[model samples]
Target chain A: MPLTSPDRTTGPLMVIGGAEDKLRKRTILKEFVSASGGADARIALIPTASSLGDEVVEVYDALFRRLGAGEVVPVRPQSREEAHDPDLVKAVGEATGVFMTGGNQLKLSAIICGTPLGDAIVEAHERGAVVGGTSAGASIQSSHMVAFGVGGATPKQRMTQVAAGLGLVKSAVIDQHFDQRNRYGRLLMIVAQSPQLLGIGVDEDTCALITVEEDADEVPHEVLRVIGRGSVTIFDPASIVSNAHEAKRSSPLLASGVLLHVLPAGAAYDLTTRTLVPQPAAIDPEDAAELAEAQRDMRQLARDIAAADASPAALRRRLARTRTKIGPNPDPLEGPVS
Target chain B: MPLTSPDRTTGPLMVIGGAEDKLRKRTILKEFVSASGGADARIALIPTASSLGDEVVEVYDALFRRLGAGEVVPVRPQSREEAHDPDLVKAVGEATGVFMTGGNQLKLSAIICGTPLGDAIVEAHERGAVVGGTSAGASIQSSHMVAFGVGGATPKQRMTQVAAGLGLVKSAVIDQHFDQRNRYGRLLMIVAQSPQLLGIGVDEDTCALITVEEDADEVPHEVLRVIGRGSVTIFDPASIVSNAHEAKRSSPLLASGVLLHVLPAGAAYDLTTRTLVPQPAAIDPEDAAELAEAQRDMRQLARDIAAADASPAALRRRLARTRTKIGPNPDPLEGPVS
Candidate 1:
C-alpha cells in the first residue's frame, strides 16, 4: 500500500539535512521563500530546536531580510501554554512559510507535539503553507523522529532511539547529517524495526523535496526530488526478510532484499513507481571530445614547456601561453571567454 | 556500463555471513560441498584467518566429514613463503571447494596475497571451483579489504582503513560481521573514497552466493542468491551523491541516493540488471489465514492458562485443552496434528 496522502492543499516539504548553505547559496531557504509566494511572502522562523535562542533568530532574521522576505517573524514559545499564545498562533496561521532550526530532535518533538503552535503549523500546512526544517528540524517533521542515540552501521538493539514528532510526513523517517554522521545504520535499524516506514537518510546540505500529488486510487502519490550538493540514501524495507526477531539483543541485524535507492542531484524519485525517474544522460559526445582534445593539447603544451624550463613558475607561464593558442571551440558556449 | 567481466572461468563465489550452522542443515556449508561436486568432492580448509588454528581445522574437518564430503584436508602456513608449499598448492588444485575460516581479515589477506597457495586458489577458481569464506575469511576475499578500524555509525577518514586483498572480487568491498559490529559505516567510507566499488555488508549467518555466469559481451553476468537465516546488505555507491571529497575530514559524510539491497534466504539479485529477481511471495492466503487464527487462539489460550495457573506445567496443560476448543484450521495442512 502507498503512503496515505496529506490533504490536497498541504504545501510540499523542503526537508533539509543539516549544515545548509546559510551563507552562500541558501538554495533551500530561497525555495522556502518561493514556496511561501516569493520575497514579499510572510514567513515565520521557529528557533525552538536551537539552544542558541536569540543569536539563532537574529541570524535567520538577517538572512530572510537579505533574501527580501517582506514579513519575517521570529517565534519562540517557552511552553505549550505560550505555544497557544494567540499572537504566536496568529503569526503561524498568517504565515506562508514556517522554518524550523536545527538542534536536539527530542527537544523539538517534545515542544511541538500537542502544542497549539504545532496544531497551528499543521493547519497552516493544510492551508498550503510550505514547512521546512534543517537537521533536528528535519527529523522532527517525520512521524517517528529519531530522538537521540549512539551511531553504528549495523542494526543492533538499542543502537537508536525514536520518539513521536509533528508527523508532517507520514510514510517516511528522515535523518539529517546522514553520511557525515554515519547515520545510515541508525536509520536502517529504525526501518528494520518499522518496515512500514521508508528510511530517508539525507546528507548534509541536501534537500529531500517531498511533493504530494492527487492520490491515484488507494495509492498515495508523493514525489521526492533530491536537491543540493549531497545525496539522499533511502532504505525501503517493505520486502525485507530477517531474523531480527530471533536474534540476540546484541546480534547484528539480518535483513534481506531491502530495496535501496540513491538519488543524486538532477534526480527525481516517484514513490508510486518505486523507481528513480530515468533522465537521459546529460554528457554530450561533442563536449567529451572537446575535453579529451583539450587534455591532449594541454599535455603537449606541458611537454614543450618542460623542454624549455622545468620550474613550477615556468610551467605556469607556458600554461598561460597555450590557453590562447588553442584553436576556436566548436560550440560558441565552449569558446574561450576572451 | 556494467561490471567488467573477468576473462576466466572464475567459479561463482559463495560469501557467507558469520555463524553459519555447522551442525544441522548446514545449508551454506553443504552448498559449498555440493558446489565442489557432491560427496566425492575434495575440499581444502585454510585456517590461517582463524586464531583458533588447529581447533578451527578440527571443527570444519569434522563438519565436512559429517556432511559426507570426501577428502577434507587442513592447511596452515605461518608465513607468505610457507604459503608457497607445493603440497598446499596440490591440495587446492585437487579441491572443488577451498574454504577460509573466520578470524582477523587482515591476517588472512596478509598471509594469502602473492603466495603460491593464493595463486593456486585463484587458478582453482578459474577452473570452476567454489571459494567460500565466513567472517574475517569473507572480508579477505575482496580486492580492498577493511583493515582494523573503530566501530561507529558515522563515516570518518580513519574510522575505516582499507588494505589490498587477494582481488578475488574486484567491484565490491566486503565487510564481515557487518550487522553485528556495526560495520556499515566502514564499508560506506570505503565506497565514498572509491565510488566505483560496491560495499557488500554480509549479515551474520547469511550467504551472498555471487555466481559469475558466462559473460555475454562486455557485461559481466553475476547472480547473487542469499542463503541462511540472515540477509545481506549491499551498498552500491555507483549513483551516490556524497561530499566526501569536499567536506572537511571530521565533517559528517554527505551521500545521497546510494543503492542498497538486503537479500534474504532464497532471494536473488542480478548484478547486470542492478535489480532483484522478483519472486512470488511464499505464504499463501490460506496459510496466512490459518496462522492468524492460530495466533488468535494462542492468545486466548494464554489468557486461559494465566487465569487457571501461572506455572509452566499448568500452562502446558491449558494449551493442550484449548487446541480442541479453537475452531477448525483454515487449511488441512495447518490443522492440529491430533
Candidate 2:
C-alpha cells in the first residue's frame, strides 16, 4: 500500500556546502541554470545570511543574469518587518527554483519560522518546486538542528544544544563543513541523544538533493537522495549511552555506533531502504565542462590571495579579524581569567 | 550532565506488558530465585509475554527459599531460535540477571540475531545480570522489537510497518495479545514480509519478571512495562515481503517500524511530553490479595493454559498446532498464507 502518489517538481534542487567564492559561485549557478530545464526558468536567490549591501546584491544579480536565468530575484529581508513581506512570499511561490545562500542559519530561522514567507517556502516544496539552501541553510532542514559545537572524536554529554529548524527532512540531522572541520564527534554526540535521527555530514563543496514522494496511499512521504562530492558521512549509533532527562551541564559524552556509508558523488542513497547505490550519471558533458572552467576560476582567486603584496604575519592578522567579524564572538566576561 | 558513570551499568530494567499466562517458564524461575548483589545482580529473563510465567519460574525450584536478585533479564529476540539459546556473549560477560519466557515474538527473533546465542541477550545483558522477559517477555527492550497496529490503520507505502517490533529496546521484536481477538490485523501483517526473526505476543494470565538496578545516577530503576491484556500478537515479516530488487511489492508486510508500549493497569499520561505515565488506580487490591494467597500454595504445578482463557481464537489455534507438532515441517509451502 503506497502512502502517496508520486509527484516530481519541474526543476531540481541545488545545495552547495560553502566556501563559494567567484569560481564556486559560477559552478553552482551553471548547475542551477541547466537543471531548470532551460534558461527561461525564473530563479529566486535568498541571501539572508549576507548583510545584503547594495554591491553584493548587484553583483549577484549580474552574475545570475549572465548565467542565463531569464529573471533573477534577490530576496533581501533586512528587518523583521520585511521578513514577512507578502510580495517576497508571492515571488518565491511563483518562481521555478529557490536558492538559499550561506550565512548564519540561526538568523534565518529567527526571521523566517512561523511567518507567511516561511509557510510559502514549505508550500512550494510540497508542490514540487526546486528548493535549495547552502551551508547553514542545509543544516536547518532537520528537527533537531545543531547550533554549534566544538570539534573532536570524543562524545561529551550536553556538548551540543539543539534548536528548532525548518522541518524539511526528518530522517537525518545534517552538519556542514564536515571533513574540513572535523565535525564527526559533534554528529556522533547528536545521534547519541536522539538515536531515531540519522547523522549526515556534508563536506564543503558537496550537496545532497533529497527528493520526497508521497506513498501511493498518502499517509507519509518517502525520501530519496542524490548525493554529490565530496561525500556524505552517515553516523548511526549502535547503542546509546546518554540519558536525556537527567543530563546536566557536566555530563561526559559517550556513544558507541557505526558509520554505515560515506557516499561520494554520483551516488544515490535511498532512505526508504536504508541503502546506497550508484546513481546513473546524469550531468551533461557540456555542463560538466562549464563546471571545470568554474573550478579553474576559483583556483585563480586562491592563487591571487596567496600572491597578495603583504607580509605573512599581516595576512594572518587580517584573516583573523575577518573571521571575528563574520563568525560568532565569545563573551568577554565569561573568559577563563582576567 | 552525564546520566551514569561509564564504569557501571545504570538502573534496573522492568517490563510489564503481558498478563500472567503468556510468559516464558525458564525466565521467570531464574529471576525469582536468584541471589541479590554481586554476580547475581546480572539476572535477566526473556518472557514470551506475561507475568504468570515469570511468577511460576520464581516458585518452581523451591517453595520457601528466598531469592536475592542482582539483576532481572528479559530476552525478546527477533526469532524463536534467538530467544531459545540466546547468544550469551554480552550477558555472560556482565549480566547478574538472565531469564527467558514464552510468548511468540517470532519465536524469539528466530533464536536471536548475530549469535552463538543471541549475543545481545546471554552475553551482553548477562554481564550485568538482572534480566527477564514477560508477555512478549517485555517487548520493546530490543532494538528490533515488534509493535501491533489496529484501529483501522492500514499498511500503506511508508506508512510505517505494523508487525514484529521496533528493534531499539533490545534487538528482538515483540507483540502482546492485547484486547483478545482485536490483534488479528496487527499480528498477521507484521510477520508477512520480514521473516528472519521471531514474534513474541503474550496472552492473558502470564507475566515475565525482569529486574534492574534500584538506582541509576540517583534515579531509581523501575520496571519498564510492555503490558497488554487478553492476548499478545506477534508478527515476523521476513518471509512475505519479497526482496526482489526491481520488482516492487505493495506495502511489503515486514516486522519493521512496529509499535510497542507498556499499557499497564493505569491512566497516567504526559500530554505535553507525549509519554505514558503510570496509573496506580488500575492495580486491583483484590488481585494483590489473590497473589498473596497463590504464594501459599507451594505444591501447585505450572499449567500450560490459564483458567481465564483470554487468548484470541487464531492464536489459540497456532499455539495448539505448534505444541502438537513433533518435527519441523520441511515443506515451506505449508507456512501461513497472506
Candidate 3:
C-alpha cells in the first residue's frame, strides 16, 4: 500500500459537509482516521478556512485525537510573511492526512497560492496523503472557486464570480452549502461560461471522498461517498451552443446546451465516465428497517411540533425561526440526537 | 459635432461608465444626441445584459429619437443559432456610436468573444465612437469583467476572476455597485493579484465620462465631470507588498499594499497624474452648512419621540427600528422633514 509508487493510487481525499456538532464530529473523525490508513496516521490541521483561529484548531485537534489520530498538528499562518515557513511546508509534505478547517476558502488561497507551502500541499496529495476540507475548504479544492453569486437555476452571464483556487482538482468547480443555499443557478452559470469544466455541488454535512485509480492507464480519479442527507448536483456542459459575437443583440445569458445530475446518498460517480451508479441494495433488510424507523420518528417530531397548543401565528413564527437556525433545509434524523 | 473622420480624436478610445442607462432611455436624450454628434449618429444597441426578457430596442429607439440620433438600429439575435447576422455586422460597421446595455456581461462575451460582431465592436471603438455600458455592460468594456465577490477590504489570491471582456479599455478592471456594496476588498484584491492593471470601482447613480483629448500630444483620454452624489474608488497596486503567499501560515487573508482614492461628487481624478482635483465643490456651502446644522434635528426627533409619553420599551423598540431603517451610518439631516 505504498502510495509513493507511480502506479499506486493515492489515498482518498475527503470533503466533509458542515454542522459538526459534538456527536457528529466524533463519527466524522472516526471515518477520517480509518480512511487515512489506520490509527497512527499523522494529520495536519489547516484552520485557514476558520480564520486561523486558535479556538477552532483546538476543537479540531481534540476531535481528531478522540478518533485515534496519532498526531494532529495545527498549522496556523499568521501573516503572508509566515505563510512561507519551511517547517510548515515540510510538515505537510510528510503528513498522512491534511485537514483544512472551515472559514474562508479565499483566505486559504491567499495564503498558500504560489508559495512553497502551497506547493508542499499539492506534493503531499500527489504522494497519497488524504486531503480534506470542510465548508470553504471544500470550495478551494476545485480549480475554479465560487467566489459569490445571486443563487438560482437561471444561468445568466456574470451571475457568478470565479476566483483563483487551490488547484486540488482541475476537472470541476466545487461549491459548498449546495442544496441548503440553493446554489444551482450559480453553478450552472459557471459551467455555461466555462463549458470545459464540470460543476460539483456538495450538500451540507456530506462528504465526497475522491480516490485516484491504481493504474496509470485509467483516468486519475474516482469519487467515493459517505453522503449525508441531501444530494450532490453535477453540471456537465460538454455540449454548448455559443457564438461569441452573435449573442450581442439578444440574451446571451440563455444557455442552449447543458446536462445536470443529482446524486443521492450512497451513490458513486465516476469522474471519467461522468455517470452515477447507485450502491447495491444488498444491505441486510433489518438495517434498512431500522433506518426507516428512525426516519419515521423524526417526521413524528415535526407533526408534534405543528399540532402543539401554541397559537397558529406564534407556531408559524417559531417554525420559521427554527428553520433558519438549522439552515435552509435540514434532515431532523440524519445524525444522532443531541 | 460629427463623430466621424473629420472630428475624431487621434487619441485612445474613451469608454463612458453609464452607457445604456443614460443613452438607451430618454433620461439624457439631449446629452446622448449631442455627445454622439448632431442628429445623424448611426447607433446600435447591444442589449446583451437585458437579453433574458423582451428586446429593449424600443427604449433605445425612443431615447435616440429624443436625443435626435438618426437611424437608431436594433440588432436581435434570436438564438445562439442566429448569432451570425450579416446585417448586424454591417450596421456596426457603419455606426458612429455603439451602446451596450446592462445585462449579463458574460453572455455578451460568450457570444461575441471571437465573432465578427465582436471584431466590429472592437474596430468601431478603435476607430473612435464612444463605447459605453451600465453594470454588466460597464463590466465588459474592460479587458476583464469582474463577475462578483463577497464585499470586503481583504486582498487574497484568486479572490477575483477575470472573464474575457470586450477589451475596449485595457487599463483597468471595472466593478459596479462599488461603495454601495462596500466592495473595496475585492477591488483591492484584484489590483494586488494583478498589479499591472488598475482597479476602478464605480458607484451607482454616477458615471465616469471619459473623453479622448485629441489636442493633447501626450496623454490620450481625459475624464470629464458630471458628478452626482455617489463616488468612485480607484485602487492602484503599484505600491503594494504582495508577499501574500508568505502570510498563509498565520492567516490566509492579507490586507496590505493597496492605494485607494475615493472620488466624491464634483471631484475628478487625473489617471495620468493620479491626483484628485476638486471642481469648486458643487454643493452650496450654505446648503452644506444647513445640512450640518440639521444634526441637532436628529437628536430633537429622538427626544420628541421619547417625550411623547409612549411605553418605554415600545418607544425604545420604535427608536431602534427607525435607526435601523435609517442605516448604520446615515446623514443626520436626511430624516423626516428634511
Candidate 4:
C-alpha cells in the first residue's frame, strides 16, 4: 500500500470523544470553529446520529454562535430518503464546516452512510471545509466503525461487531469513551481479528484532530494531534501476532506485540508512518512570559514568608506593604532583598 | 531537570519482563549477550534477588557461555554484609556486563540497594558496561520501583506500594509481567499518586532496551526501544488529573488524561521528552532483499497456478518441469509467461 493515499481530503477533521466540555473550556469546539475560518465559519450541524430531536441541534447551534461562527445550518436527515434530499446536499456543500453530534453510531451510518448528503460532506471536505464530530460522530469518521461491544482488557472472540464508517480517516477503527468506559478490550479484539487496521480509542472530552501535512518529500501525510482534557490511544498492529483467526467463541485471543501509543494534548502522530512527530522547538511566547512572571511572584512570596517568620497574617501584611512601596507598575523581583 | 542527567550512567540497560523464554529462539538473551560485547564479554551475574541458590546463577552461566560469552562471575550476596564485600565489589567492577536475576524485588533492594557491590555495578555502568536484568531486575533499574501490587484496570487507593530503585531510569517506576498479570491498575495507581513519575509496564518475554543518542541540537536523549515477543507500556502522567491524595481505602482514584504508550519491538520512545520517537527512514538491506525475493516467488507461484488451471498436483508437476528446463540456479521469474 502507498504510504500516502489520495483517498483522503484536504480539509481538517475534529474527531472528538463524548461529553466534550460545553460549559467550561470548549477548547475542542473552539478549535473546530477556528479551523473552519474563525468568525466567517458557516457550519452545517448534522444531528442525525443524535436520537434527541431539535434540542441536540439547538445546543450545538448556540455553542457555534457563541464561539463566533458566522452561521449554523441544521441538516437533520431522519431517514435514508431524507438523506438523499438535494437541498440537504447543497447545504452541506456550501458549509465551511460540517459537524456530527453524539448518539447511536449505527443509526447515523444507516441513515447517511451512502446517501447524497454523505457524498456532499465528503466533497466539501475535499474543497477545504472542516469536518468535526463527537462520540458516535467520532466513530463514523473511520473506515470501520464499532457497532457495539463489550468492555474489558483481554481480546475475546465475538466480543464486538463492526460497521462501515465514512472512510475519512482510512484503515482505522475508532471507539469513543475509551478508558472511561473500559472499551480497551473491544478495540483490541477488533484490531486483533483484523491486524491490518489501526485501532484508535479516544477518551471522553478529547479530540483526535487530524490534518494533512506535507513532509520533506512533499508527500501529504495525515497527522493526528490530541486536544482537550483526555488522551487518544492508538493500537498499531502492523507487527502483531494473534490467535484471533482460530480462537473459539468467547475465548481470549492472544494479541501479543501490538504497538500502542497514548497521546495527550500537544502530541502529534503521523498516520502514514504510524510514528509520533516531534513537537516544535519554540515555546509559545505568551506562555513563556506568564511562566517567568509566575516565577518572579513565587520568589517574592517566599522572601516575604521568610521575613514574616512563617505567619500567614504577617506575610499577607508584608506583601501589602511591599505592593504599596513598589507602586502600580512594580516588578515583584524588585522587592526588598531581605 | 536536564534532558540528559549525569546521574544516569553511560551503559545500556536490557530491562526484561519476567518469564523470558530460555529455550526456543532466546532472542532477548541473545541480544543481551551481543550487547555485552559478544565473545569478549565477562558478565557479572547477581542472583541476590532469587530465593533459590546456585541454580539461578547456573541457568544464566550456561546460557551466556552457550551464547559465546567469555566468562560469567557470580556476584550472589545473601545479606547486606555480603553485599559490602570488597571481593564481590571488585568482581562486579571488573565485569563487562552486570545482570540481575528475577525474584523478590524488595529482598533485592534490602541486600544491595546501598551496598559496595551495588555501587560497583553503578560504576561499571558508568564506565560503559552493559547492565541487564529480568523481572525484579527490571524494577530495580528505575528510580521508583513497585514492591508489590494488586491487579485491575481502575486505579484505586492503596492498590500498590513503591520502593527506591538504583535510579538508572530517572523519575520512572517499572513493573514486570504487566498485562499478563493484570498489573495496569497498580502501575496506574503509582503514577496517579506521583504524577511526576513515568510508569512503565513490561509484558512477559519482552525487554525494554534503553540507549542514549545525541540529537541535532547536541542534546543527548535516552531512548527506550522495545525488543522480544511482547511490548513495553508507558504511562506518562505529565498532564494527569488525579484524586489519589484524598481517595479513601480501595476507592477508585481519578486518573484522567494520563498519556499511555504500548510499544512493540522496533518501536522507540524518547525517555527525556516522554514522547514516541520516529523510526529511521531506511529499511534494512537484508529485509528489502528478502521482501523482493518473496514477491517474485509469490508472483511465479500465481502464474504457475493459472497455467495449471487451479490444480495443485498439476501446478507441482509444472514447477518441476520448469525447474528442469531452466537448469539449476534459475530465476523463478524466468518461467514460461503462461
Candidate 5:
C-alpha cells in the first residue's frame, strides 16, 4: 500500500533486544541518535515500562545528550488515565525521536496499548519520527506480544501467553533476550499456534532497524537490518506442523517444518515478500577510484618483481628507479626488500 | 502462476526426514502408496543415491508390492550415460509414483542433475505422478541442495555447501536428519548468506507432504502438511543480518533476525504466502450426529440423576427403567450404579 502512496513516508523503527550499550561502544544508541536527526533531534523518553523511577529517565537523558541529541524529555504514564493525559501526548507528538526503556513489557502494554499516548506515538511514526525501544519496549512493537513464557527449545502448549502490542510491526510477534535468555521455545510455541504471525527473536544488545524501501518491481516493502553486537533470529513457519492446540499443559509440542533464518549484523530481510533482501555492493566512488589506483600500482610492482627474477640487487635497483620516477618519496606500494 | 493456470497440475511431493519406519505402522510409506493410486499403483524406485547395490531397490520393490502396488520397477542410473538411456527414462515416466532412497545427496545430484533422467522426473511430476524421497532424497527435492554440511546450532562460515536439486520445491533448500543430526547451523548458514533461499529442516521419521491447494481468494498455492512422528522446521529469513559474506574460514557467523516455524503432524503451511494455512474444522457427519445424540442422552441422564438425588435405590430403579425402555440392552454409556 505504501508503494502506491508515493508521498507516504513513515519513520524508521528500531527494535532493540534489551541491554543496549549505554556505556562503551553504544553502537545501537548512536545509530538511533543519527536516525532521529542527530544534533537536531528532540527525543522523548517513555520510562513507564521500567520499575526504576526518575533514575532511568535521567540516565537516558544524559546518554542522549552525550550522543548529541538536541533535546530530551520524559513522558512517563504510570496508568491508562495518566497515558491519556494531553501533556504527555503532546510531548511524544512534538519529539523527532521516541525511546522506551526496558522493564516489564506486560506493564507497558497494559498502560499504553489503547491510550492516547500510544496513538500519539503511532502518529509520530506516521509523520516520520524515529521510534525505538529495548526489551519491554521491543516486545511491545509487534501486534502479538509475548506476555510471559518459559525458556527452552521445545515448543509446548500454554508455554507462553500473548498480549496485544502497539502493532508497529504488523502480523508478527517479537521476543527479546533470545539466545541469552533462551526464549526460543516460547517464541516457537507462539508461532506454532498462530502460524499466520511471524516470530522474531532478537538477542541482547542487538537492534532490528526497520525501514521502508522499494523493490526492483518498485513495490514498497519494509526491510529489517540488524545493528549491534548480537544477531536477530526470525521464524517464518510457512508450512508448519504442530500439535500446539492439543498438547496438554507444558508438554513438548511436535513442531515440524519450520523455516528458520538467523541473520547477524548487515543482513537485510524483506517483510512484504517474506524473503531476505540482498545487500547492494556499496562502495563509495572515491573509495573505488582510490582502490583501483592502488590495485594498478600493485600489479605494476609485481611485474617489476617478476622481471627482476627476485635478485636482491635487481629488486633494489628497480625499487630505486620507481622511487626516482615518483619524485623521491618511498613508494607506498613498494616496501623495502628484506 | 499455478493459481492463474487452472489446468496446470503438479504431483504431490513428500520430502521425508530420513529413517521413516519400514516396519511398525509405516505411516509415511502407506500414505505414499495411497497417493500413488494404491492397489492399481505402478511404483518406480530410483536408488541412485544409495551405496548399497541391489539391496535398497529390492527392499523398496518388495515393500511396494507388499503394500499392494500392482507393479514395482527398479530404474537406477549408475552414470550420466545410464541416466540418458531411454529405457530408464521410460520406466520413471510410466510409473504412478517415483521414489528416491536415502544416501549421498551430492552423488545423487551429480548423476541426476542436467541428465535426461532428471528431466524425465520433472516431466513426471508435471504430469501429476506422486514423487517421494527420504533423507538425501529429501534434500535433493528443492532448488538448492545441501550437498554436505556439519551439524550444530551456531552458524559458521563454510558450514555447508549447496548443490542443485530437482527444484520441485522452488526457492528453498532442504536438510534431512535435522534436529536428530543437529543440522540447524548449516541450514541457518545457507540462508544467512543467500538470504533469498528459504531454509527447511526436517526431523527424523517425519515427512513434509506438499500438495497444491487453492486459497480463499481461489489462488493456487503449495501447502506442506506434516506426517509421521517428528517435526518440520522452516526458516523464513525475511530480514536477516548475517556476517556470512565476510566471516573468515570456520569462524562462527552472526545470523540475526531469522524467523523460525516448527510444525508437527497435521500442520499445514502455505509456501506462497509464507504463512500457515488454517486447517479446516474436519468432522465426519455421521460421527457428529452420533456425538450429538450421545450428548443429548448424557444430559437427560444427568437430569434423571438430579431428580433421583444420588439415592442408591432410586439410581438402580432409573437404570432398570432405562434398560427396560431399551428392550433389555445394556446402556453403552452407563455402568452399574457402583
Candidate 6:
C-alpha cells in the first residue's frame, strides 16, 4: 500500500447496491451528493442501459437536485457513436460526480467499452470525481464483472458467468442487489474461479464507500465504510480451499475456508489487510474458550496457507481440503429463519 | 416462405433449455446427434462456458459415444487468444455437429464473441452442421441476448436489458430455464422494449428445432418445432401496446395484447407468419362462437396494426393500452402455491 500518498487526491468511489430508496429519505444518493462537493457538485448521468433514457434522466435529475446538487445534467449517447462525441467527453471531464442508471450492465459495456468518452470518465475519476451506480451500474464497476449469473444460495460450478467490465475496481468484483437476489452462491463461484480477487456482495439499499487514504509514508490504503440500511458481505477467495474446477459440471461445488466478513452499516474494513476494522469503543465479550479456539484456528490457517505448495490456483486445481480443520462447536450451516 | 429449396441441406439449430437428462433416456442430445448425420457425425464440443471443462467434455463425449456417434472431439480454448487459433477454427468449420456446454453464458461470449471461432461456428451451421447448446448455451443463440434483468411475475419498467448476441436467430430472443426461473416477466419486458422481435421462453429438458425451409416461391421461412418434455412459450409482442419506455424507472410496466402461445412437444411454429402451424392430424375446436371470437380478435389486431404508427418502439413511447382486449375472463393475479 502506498503510505497514504500525499499527492494523490482522487475522490472516493461510492458503489451503491441496488434498490436505494428514492421516495423516502434518499439516504444513499444524498451521501453520494454530499461527498461529491455538495451544492457545488456537477453530476453527469448515463442512462444508456435502459430503454427510457428520458424518463430515467428526469427521475435522477430531480432526486439529485432535491438532494442539493448544484447542477444535474444528463450525458446521453443516443448510439455507441455518440459515446465518442467531444462535447460529451468534455462534460464528463469537468463533472465532479457521475452516476449511471440501472438497466442492462452489458449495454453499458457495449457502448462504453472502447470509446473516447469512456476514457474521459476514467480520467475524471482518476482526478477527483466520485463515480456511482446501482444494480447493473454497480455490477459494471469491476474489471471482472458477473455479466449475468444464475440465482442460488448454494455454491455450484454453473452459478456464475463473468465478462469484461469497466475496470474501476481492479482488485474487487462488485455484486449489487446481493441479499435480495440471493447472489452469494454466484459470488462464491466467481471467487472460487479466481482466488486472487476479492468478492464484494452489496445488499439492497446498502452502499460501500471505498476511499483510498494515503498515509504519511504515501501508501494508499483503500478503506471501506458501510453506509445505508444493509451490510456488505466480503469474500476472500484467496483463503478458500476449493476444487470447483475439478468437480463435474453437474455436481455441487466443494469450497472450504473461504474467509468471510460481514460489515453492517456503520462498520468499516481494511481491504488490504482483509479484515474488519473494529468500530470505535466496540468491545469483545470475555469468552476465554471461544477466544482460545479462534487463536488456535488462526494459527493453523497461517501454517497451512504458508505451505510451499499452497498457491492461489492450487486450491481450485486440486481437491486438497484445508489442513485447518474446524474446531468443536462450529457455526450451524442453516441460519435462523423468520 | 421459401419455395421448397432442396439444394440447401443444412441441418437445423437445436436450442435446448436447462437440465436435459443424461442418466435416463438422453433424448435432447440424442436428437441433436441424429440430426447431425447420426453415427458418422463429427461432433465438436465447446465447453468454454463451463468452469469444469474437462468434466463437461467427458460427459458429452461419453454420451455421444454411447449414443453411437462415430467421432466426438473437444474444442478446448483456455483463453480468448486461443479462440482465434487456426486449428480450433478449422475444427469448428468442419464439424457435422457442435455443442456448447452449460455454465456461464458470458464466458462463452467472452471467449467466442468476436473471435474467428465464433464466425467459423456460424459458417459450419450454414453449411449443414447442427449446432446445439444447453442452458447458457441456449440463451446466446439470438441476435439480441437478455443480458440480465430483475425477477418478478408482474412486469416492471426495469425488468429487462438487452445486448448484442450471437445472431443465430436474427428476429428472435431466447430465454433458458424459462419456467424454472420464472422468467416470463423478464422476457415480457424484453419484448415490450422491442415489439418487433419475437420472445421465446424455453423450459428445462426442452429443445426447439429451428430450421429455415423454402416454399415453392423460393423465400426462406423459419419454422420452430418443439421436442423433449416441457413446453416452449412464444410471445409475439408486435401487437402489444406498451408503456415501458415512457414510464419512470420505479414504475411498474404496462403492456397489453402481447400474443402468447405455449406449445408442447410435437408442436410447430411458423416464425415468418407469426402463427402456430397445425400438427399433422390435429383438428380445430367445434365451438363456433369461440372460433368467431378468435377470428374477430385477429382481424381487429391486423386493422389496428395497419393503421400507421404501430412500430415496435411506438408501444414504448406512449401508454397506448392494447385495443384488442382479452376475451372472456382473465385469471386472478395471485397464483397457487405448492
- Candidate with best DockQ: 1
Cα lDDT tens digits for candidate 6, A1-338: 22223225666778888889999988899999997788999998988877889999999999999999998879988678999899888888889998988888888888887798788777777898999888888888887888887765445677678888777776678888875676756787788778777888887888888888764676776788888776676776664555565544643444444555555566677776655665453323554455665677566555546753667676433324432343343332221211
Candidates sorted by TM-score, best first: 1, 5, 4, 6, 3, 2
Candidate 1 or 5, higher TM-score? 1
Q: List the candidate numbers ranked by lDDT, top first.
A: 5, 4, 1, 6, 3, 2
Provide the lDDT at B299 for model 1.
68
Q: Where does model 5 exceed 4 Å of error? A: A1-187, A190-245, A248-338, B1-7, B216-218, B241-243, B281-338
Backbone steric clashes in candidate 1, count: 23
Per-residue lDDT of B146 in model 5 = 96
Tell me the tens digit of each residue's lDDT in model 5 across B52-100.
9599988888888888888888988999889999999999989899999
**Candidate 6 docking DockQ:** 0.02
lDDT winner: 5
Query: For model 6, what is the alpha-carbon lDDT of residue A173?
Result: 84
DockQ list for all candidates: 0.20, 0.02, 0.01, 0.05, 0.18, 0.02
**Docking category of candidate 6:** incorrect
The prediction achieving the highest TM-score against the true structure is 1
Cα lDDT tens digits for candidate 3, B1-338: 11122123522332334432443343434555556664778877777667653446777677777667877777555444445678988888887777776677777777766788888887877687656566777788777778766653333445557777877656678887664555644665566567677788776655655554432455343553334334455666665444443322222232233444445444455555444543442445666776665767677667757766766777667667867886554556564234
**What is each candidate's fraction of native interface contacts (fnat)?**
0.32, 0.00, 0.00, 0.03, 0.36, 0.00
Candidate 4 Cα RMSD (Å): 11.9
TM-score each candidate: 0.61, 0.40, 0.42, 0.52, 0.54, 0.43
Candidate 1, residues B1-338: lDDT per residue as tens digits? 45555544778687877889987788898888888777888889999988889999999988888777887988788788889889988899888899999988888878888888988887877788889999887888888888878665445555768888877777678887776676766777788878988788887778889886554564556778888876677877777656566444454454455667765566677765566676555565666786687777666655765767557777666657756887443433344332
Model 1's i-RMS, to one decimal, reads 5.5
lDDT: worst 10-residue window of model 6 chain A = A329-338
lDDT of 1 at A91: 93
RMSD after CA superposition, every candidate: 10.7, 24.4, 27.4, 11.9, 12.8, 25.0
Residue B293 of model 2 has an lDDT of 47
Tens-digit per-residue lDDT, B1-338, candidate 2: 11222223532333434444323443333333443254335454444343355465454222212344444444334444544453434444455544555455544544554455455543444344344444454554555555334421112223224333323343234444333323322333333334444344443442323233243244433233322222122232332322212112333221222222222221222211213333333324665665454543321212223522555575556546755884433232222222
User: Model 2 residue A131 lDDT?
Assistant: 72
Candidate 4 chain B worst ten-residue window by lDDT: B329-338
TM-score of chain B of each: 0.80, 0.32, 0.69, 0.83, 0.83, 0.79
Residue B249 shift from truth in candidate 6, angstroms: 32
Off by over 4 Å in 4: A7-9, A281-338, B1-144, B147-162, B165-338
